[model samples]
Target: MGGCVSVSSRSTCSSRSNGERISPSCLWIDMFRRKRSRRTFSDHVTTLQHLSSIPSRIFTNGRSSSACIFTQQGRKGINQDAMIVWEDFMAEDVTFCGVFDGHGPYGHLVARKVRDTLPLKLSSFFDSFGSKQNGSGANCCNGNMKSDVADPVKETSTEDRVESLWREAFLKSYKAMDKELRSHPNLDCFCSGSTAVTVIKQGSNLFMGNIGDSRAILGSKDSNDSMVAIQLTVDLKPDLPREAERIKRCKGRVFALQDEPEVQRVWLPFDDAPGLAMARAFGDFCLKEYGVISIPEFSHRVLSDQDKFVVLASDGVWDVLSNEEVVEIVSSAPTRSSAARILVESAAREWKAKYPTSKMDDCAVVCLFLDGKMDSESDYEEQGFSSATLQSNHSGNVVESDDGQNSEPCLQRNFTVRSSEENDQYRRVPIDADVEDAENGGTEDQNWSGLEGVTRVNSLVQLPRFSEERPRP
Candidate 1:
């Protein structure tokens, strides 16, 4: 005796087996709810899949929507340079870029390891501290700099806070990275190490961290609307005054070799093994005990409308091309995607023409455009001449002399020169006169064994330990 019950003017339902009434409207609503639940579940799965793919966004050697990266192997056995540009690094609108230059037998491995893991560590630190605005996180990041009188929390500006947060992140990440290298089971970092030049761009703010000799520079427009090259990171060579002081204080020796007087290197106290060209780097455990640290120099900058782009590169590029030359080459590029490749090619040609007899060092570059655009038409017309012609014109401007006197552009002047009187202050490991003569007098056809730019030995030889008591000679 079941009969249909009309719930509304447009819908009705029949009685069920239990003699209860049901409305078609209710049934439709229930079905719609179930369908929506399924749809929501599917959306969540899709979101998780996208989140898992974030690592794929890190480009090692390619062009991205906002950046371009390129690397070239040298005559050296293997390419030891590594670089990356990660978009949406930690949060939306943030980007991270880095260039690593490895030196020593296992330098390539060390560089790649840092290139992959460092940014992750930084992101982790940033996230861990981001939640606690006024808690132990802030205090720990600030170290012992908390003011006793004025409230630092209230006195800090927006720029200061951002800089402080990133500064802590860089410091901790670099220290942790070096520690990991020291304890890594598979990697041998005893005498091997890598240089790092990294930058994080969040909106209009830029934070940079650097160690060793790799460099970062900005290409910006001046008041006259002319392109200008601004160096961001100092090359942390062993010859820098503060760097030399720290190494000497830690019982590490710093001096130039007989052949390359202009290049100063860090050496061991008891033995002349593993002469590292830079004052700071990741790995090189032997030198680590002798004041070679892995601490990065941090800097911050607020981007301006005049700012054009940034270029991060290994020492290989810097050794041959000047900062202005690099900026000119990049600005004149026909397209943003081709800028890094063109710059690397220009550096390669310069290396061949500048130091033909020397083995070229590995080159890596990352070019980041700030405004997300390049004036291809203007650049093409401005640089109508070929790269070779531009290079020839640049080379003809000034000649480098033996006395280090050059009318060359002020920025291109070499600063590694140390007077003989200055050299007398440091204890130098003596080299056999015969060996020195052989190296200097060697023929061009002779195969070079050591690294070219830094003059690194192939392997570190362990010398015999001398006894406290001297026997008759």
Candidate 2:
């Protein structure tokens, strides 16, 4: 807790419009309640975004009613996952949460870079646009609420504009991120990159951006008041027909190996170089020609009064835990600060049990309770569930699948797909021209690929830009 850098005074970043700045407070997961200090943007704007990844859990307390906890562990010896959450984003009632999952040789570097930098980009843009979301300045931002402003008109006018602003920021930031990866003096993205899935919660609305296989889900009460899982983003895997179709349309090969029949991947049209499992990602310049893209899938949802929490996780968690199972585990946590840690530990245990032969993958989770805060005085009774009973009753329960319908025992065969060499009619053209493929010198690909110390991440890049010219090897 002491070692990890805790970002504070993020509300100051929203001060340009709200004119309200928060006092310095520990801004990690809701694990630790530190003394609050009034800080300003000029104070942390530079160093905060460059904060290094930590091996242990990091807690950043923002408000008394919100709690977020994070944890990570290495699998197969490398942890190529990263996560970041900026609750009280531009608008006080909003939160920005992101998880990145990296694969390949330099995946760890790419994931960490995105994990630390993306939110800063989003925050900068939000403040720049001056787009206001209703209730932005109320108690949420520590600013005065415009009580005279009508809700309907203010919401109707601001929602679309603010949303459009966020979309533009996502697109621009993703593009810049990929470009940075490709040109990184030390990192190589030719065959490496990461998946990204993020959600911006402003007021009751959620805006999500996803790329690759990692996922985001919401836990809310159905009409009957029972807890239910609502999937907020699709897993952008190569198996998706639309994804596969797009790859083929770009002359990119999309098929699975005989041994790994279920795991569809993208390969170089000319050389069997890097094979990426997800359809979209940042970097992976080598596969960009074969229809592998970095653009994100964006969607929006309005929160209901019954909405309880949101979960953003890397594939490591999704591969073993059902959206419902995750909801159950988190919802049952003895406390809000312990929710993410418990969920990650559960995934690690499942990975060991289900895939005994393979190394465990890095796992990361961000849990935001709708009304839960980071106050030490807030008791479990106030968190909407019985802490004493939530975890005790479901402590040993096994998770089934993503769908939550199957009750079968957990098995490796249910999620793991082996990779093998199999070929379809994929074009592999050799190039004679002096192609600038190695446009940027990269980080030690071999070393970073294993992510010896890096931990978990998730989801995307910019929108698709189909080019007629083939990619060079």
- Cα distance off (Å), candidate 1, residue 116: 0.7
Relative to the unseen true structure, what is the C-alpha lDDT of residue 404 in candidate 2, on a scale of 0 to 100?
A: 17
Q: RMSD, model 1, all Cα superposed?
A: 20.7
After TM-score superposition, the amount by which residue 325's alpha carbon in candidate 1 deviates from its true location, in angstroms, is 0.4
Model 1 residue runs over 4 Å out of place are 1-56, 134-156, 374-473
lDDT of 1: 0.65
User: How do the predictions measure up, each by TM-score?
Assistant: 0.67, 0.66
TM-score winner: 1
lDDT of 1 at 309: 97
lDDT (Cα, tens digit) per residue for candidate 1, span 8-64: 222223233576544322221221121112225466345434532455353344555
Off by over 4 Å in 2: 1-65, 131-154, 375-473
Task: For candidate 2, write residues 297-345 as lDDT tens digits.
Answer: 6766656678899888888787667777889998888777668767888
